[model samples]
Target: MSNDLFINLFVQITNMKQSFLAIVVMTSLVIVSCKKSATTNTNPQYKALTEAVYASGNIFPKNEYKLTANADGFLLKQIAFEGDIVSKNQMLFQLESATQDARLEAANNIFRQSEANFSDNSPILDELESQLRNARTKLANDSINYQRYKELYERNATTRIDYERAELAYQTSKNDVSARRKAWLRTKNQLYVDLQNSKSNFRVNAREDDNYRIKSFMDGKLYEVYKKQGELVRRGEAIALIGDANEVYAQLAIDESDFVKVKVGQEVLIKIDVYKDKVFKARVSKLYPKLNKADQTFRIDAEFTDEQPNAYYGMTIEANIIISQNPRVLTIPKNYLVGSDSVWIEENGDKKKIKIIKGVENLDMVEVKTGLTEKSVLVLGN
Candidate 1:
């Protein structure tokens, strides 16, 4: 085409291009203005703030303990069941005691025999008494005969040799009586000792037999029964779980980092898995000094301050222990903070970073102690 026509075409194309560039620039400006307007800004406001430490634990009955058997045997009878209330020293189980029973019978038989031997009517004692009586009679006769021989010797009514022979016979009879009496006394003393030993043996066997009947250690409810009737039970084996039925407490594991902040009587907010929608209030009741090395945590116990939920043993729970709180303080959303100790504030349409003194802080908010006021506008950091 002609030079002028070509030039006209080029100029039209150039003007069209310039018009498109102008529209794009205007669109960019509008987008930029929108984004600036969309930037979030907040002001410090007076609000209640709480600082807490997170913990996890379980619910446990108070004074819980395992009931274990003291003697090995087959469980013959289960006298108590789960949920049964038992008194201290009440029999809860009866173990099979065939061997013990046999031993007890033997002990009783020996004890009865020993009793017969010790009684006044005992055959052994009666024989010893008869022997003693015979000895005494012989001694009395020998004394009379010796006195008669002495009178005969003094009156010269009998020969000296005859008197001497009579004296010798009297002395010999006296010696025989003394030996018989001594033997009787020794036999009687031996019988008495044997009876005492048998009585002691019977008592020991009786006490051992009683161990087959397991009894409760406290007045509480039975939470679990580990063994059923006819189950074999070994000594020191746990047979049941027992604890206070009406009272329960939270056993918490606090992290070592947060352990120092926990103390007795601190308020706790607990959320149990069973009661998902409800929050229970409690106070720290105990703090264990020993650290659990396996998990690097310390044990803490808390008691409910309000109505407790229907909780069972070992129910998992999450808790927040309130360390400190401020009823009303100047606070800002935690996202607005730039770093550990500074925040971005909007000043005269410009963003400025300023240092702040932070107090109590939670996951969502931070209490501003000395940096921003209620009127100060805070800018969320990038």
Candidate 2:
């Protein structure tokens, strides 16, 4: 209740408040310091590291082809449909071939007629042969009679007029024989030509018939069907697409910077969207010389070294082209790398930056060729 006592009490309260605030500030500082010390550190270790160039691509059947119609007609039937596995020379389509069939029939009829005319017992040839035989017999008889008449006339045993008649008859018989032989030869040549022409016409019709039936040239699975029954298809119209089902390859595109590093026969790892958890092994089969203008990427084709898993055409694929590898080398998680050749290391409980000689690197790990050892600790952070 005294004035001196009240002043003393106020002084004690103000001092106590100041002391509590000071304690709170010091405790906050200690907590902040402890939180900062919680850093992740990893020691470099020996591991297998691989360097790869990223690429995107798709799976395609080997020797894929589009089937086109060779002749124009209404599609009468589809012998093979999409998803059907067909062999070489297998019929895939049948166009309406009524006109071709008629043509073939007419041609066959003409060929049969020509063949009959050219037969060994043909009437025209037979008549010509009979006339030639008769003429030859007459010529033989006239020649003998002419010889006797000439001898008799020379000896004056017969009149000169009789000998002249005999000679004339002999000459006439010779002319008749020659004329008959020429007629027979002409008939034979004409028949032979007619037969050849008929045979040629028949083949032309047969080829036209073939055009109406579309056949496959390679063994493959028909991936697409472009025409339906009763649809009018023009010549050279694509009717189907086909490719080998068991044989497949990946067509990929890599960045232009990696074009030089990717070579034929290098190993490739392919990951497809459909096969989410599986990784397939493939080898670089071909390298295209030209770059893709749209994406500014180089093209690569790879074949599966192992049996290709059953896959559809044009499936999305992500691939890594392994450029180089280091086995059992000192490596660190790539996340710890700060730059192309630098990493942050912890030395004496403090963060220190060091430049390193780097080798093969991949999506997850980096190979340290020099400037780091198992004793070096790496500070991994964002």
Candidate maximizing TM-score: 1
Q: Assess each prediction's global lDDT (C-alpha) against the native.
A: 0.77, 0.78
Candidate 2 lands at a TM-score of 0.80
For every candidate in turn, the CA RMSD to the true structure comes to 17.9, 17.8
- The pairs that clash in candidate 2 are none
lDDT of 1 by residue, 255-313 (tens): 78888888899988777767645667899999999989988888999999988966377
lDDT of 1: 0.77
The clash count of every prediction, one per candidate, is 0, 0
Return the TM-score for each candidate structure. 0.82, 0.80
Give lDDT: candidate 2, residue 75.
99
